[model samples]
Target: MSTEGSVSNDREGHVKTEGERSFWGRLANWGLYQTLMTVITLSPRRQFFILAAFPILWLLTQHLGPMLQMLRVSLLDAYPVAPDVAQEFSLESYFKFFGDPIFWMPLFRTLIFAAVFTLCTLLITYPVAYFLARHVSRKNQMLLLLILLIPFWVGEIVRTYAIMILLGNTGALNLALKWLGLIDRPIPFMYTSFSMGLGMVYLTALYMLLPLYSALEKLPKSYNEAAADLGAGAWSRFRKITLPLTIEGISSGSTLVFLISTGFYATPVLLGGPSTTVFAETIAGFFHVAGDEWPTGAAFAVIMFIVALLITGVFQRLMKSLRKGESS
Candidate 1:
C-alpha cells in the first residue's frame, strides 16, 4: 500500500510541472499573436502618420511657435504693452521691408555676397579635392585633411581677429610690404567688402572642401581610364566624367556655404563697413541697437530661414534632375 501511495504522489508532482509549463507557453503565444495583429491591422499610411507625429510635434514646439508669435507681432501696427494686450493686425513690417530700399537692398546684397562666396569656395576647393582624391597616398591624404582642420581648432572669433591683424593697414602684411619696399604706404584693407568676403570664404571653405573630397574619393579610376581609352582628351574626361560624378557633393557644399554666408554676423561685422551690411546686421540693429523689437527680429529670422530653405530645395532638385539625366 505504501509503494502504491509513493507512485501516485510522483505522478501528481509531474502533472503540476507540466501544467505550469503549459500556462507560460500559452501566455507567450498570446503576446506574440497580439503584437502580430497590431502590426498587420495598421495601414502603411496610418503607420507613417503615427511615426511622423513626433517630429511634427517637436517642430511645432521648437520652431513654429516662435515663428507664429513673430508673424503676429510683425503684422501689428504698434508693440503690445503686456502679454495679455490685444491689437489689430497690420502689414507694417512687411510694407517696411518692401517699401524701404534700405531693408530690401541689404537682403539683395546678402544674397549676392553668399552667391559670390559660394562660387569662389567651389573654385578654390575643387582642384585640391581632385588632387587629394586621385593623386595623394592615403597617409598623405589624411595628413592634408588634418592640416585643413587645424585652423578650426581655434575659435572663430580668434581666427577672425587673426585675419584682422593680418589684413589691417598697420598690420603684419603692411609691415612686411613696407619693410620689403614694395609700397610707400600701408594699404587700407580692413573694413571693406573685400576683407569681409575673404573672411567669409576663409571660415566656410572647409564645408566645400570636405564634401567635394568625399565625392571625388568615391569615384573609381576605371571611369577616367575608360574615357581615355575611348580617345577622350583630359578636359573632355574631366567635364564629362569627373564633374558629372561629383555633382551631388558640389550641390551639398554650395548650399551649406551659401546658407551660412547669408547669416554671417561676426566676420562681416568685424571686416565690413556701412556699405557691406548684411541682413543679419540689420536684424541685430533692430533687436539690440533699436528698441529691442523681438517681433521684428523674429520676422526677419523667419524670412531668412524660408529663403534659405527655398534656395536649398531648388538646388537639390536641379541636382537630382541632372543625376537622373546622367543615369539615363
Candidate 2:
C-alpha cells in the first residue's frame, strides 16, 4: 500500500508540470501582449532591434502615410468633381499656385514672419541664456529655469489670451499708461504686425531658449579664458570662439522657431492684420471655407511642405559648411 501511494504521487507531479508548460505554450500563440513579453525569449540584440522597430513603424504609418496621400491629392484635380472621378492627375493645381500671387503671397508672408520671429526670439533668448550659462551657479540655474518655465506651464491659448489682456485697448497696459499719464489714448497694441510678432515671440521663446542654454552650457570656459590670456578682445573672443561652438544651438533654435512660426494660425489671425495671413490660415481656409477647392488647398499644402524642406535644407547646408570649415 505504501509503494502504490508513492507512485501515484510521482504521476500527479509530472501531470502538473506539463500543465504549466502547456499553458505557456498556448500563451505564446496569443496576440501582441504575449509577443511583446516573449522578447525575453529572443536574443538580446534581436530583442532590442524589434523593440525599436515597433514604434518607428508605427510613427511612419501614422505620420508619413497621410503626408504621401496629401501629396497624391495635390497632384490630382479633385476639386469641382469627385476625388475619384475622371480626374487627370496633372500639375494644374501647382501651376495655379505658381500663376496666382494670392496663393504665393501667403508663402512669402509666412517666410517673412518665420524669419523675423526666429530672429527676434533668438535675440531675446540669447541674453537670458547667456547670463544664465555664464553667470549663474548650477543650483541657482535650476531655480531660475523653474521660474522661466512657469508661464509656459499654461496652455498656448491661455498664454495668447494673457497677451490679449496686456495688449487690448482697455486692458492692463492701456490702464497703466493712463495711470502714468503716458498717453491720452490706448495704443493700438493688439492687432498689428508688432503685436503679432510680439505674440509669436512670447509663444515660441522657449523653443529657442532651451537649445541656446544647452549649447552654451556645454561650452568650455577654458576656450574663453585661453582667448583672454592671449589678449583677445571681448568681441573678438566671442566672434571667434564662443559663437562657433554655439552655432549648433543657434541653427537648431532658428530652424524649430521658423518652422513652427510658419504654421501659426490662431496667434496670427487674432493678433495680426489681414495682411499677415500665413500658410496655415490659407490651408485651413481652403478646406473649411471652400469645400470644392480641396485640391487647391492640398496643392498649397504640398508647396508649403516643400518650402519647409527647403528651409531645413538651407540650414543643413549651412551647418555642413560650418562643420567643413571647422574640419579644414
Q: What is the lDDT of every predicted structure here?
A: 0.84, 0.84
Candidate 2 lDDT by residue in tens digits, 61-122: 88898998788788877655665688668888889987978888989888887888888999
lDDT of 1 by residue, 61-112 (tens): 8878876777777766666545677676766666667778888788889988
Candidate 2 residue runs with Cα over 4 Å from true position = 1-57, 79-84, 323-328
Query: What TM-score would each prediction reach against the true structure?
Result: 0.78, 0.82
Candidate 1 clashing pairs, residues 3+ apart or interchain: none
Query: What's the residue-level lDDT of 172 in candidate 1?
Result: 95
What C-alpha root-mean-square deviation, in Å, does candidate 2 show against the real structure?
8.3
Clashes of each: 0, 0
- Give me the runs in candidate 1 sitting further than 4 Å from their true place: 1-59, 80-84, 289-292, 322-328
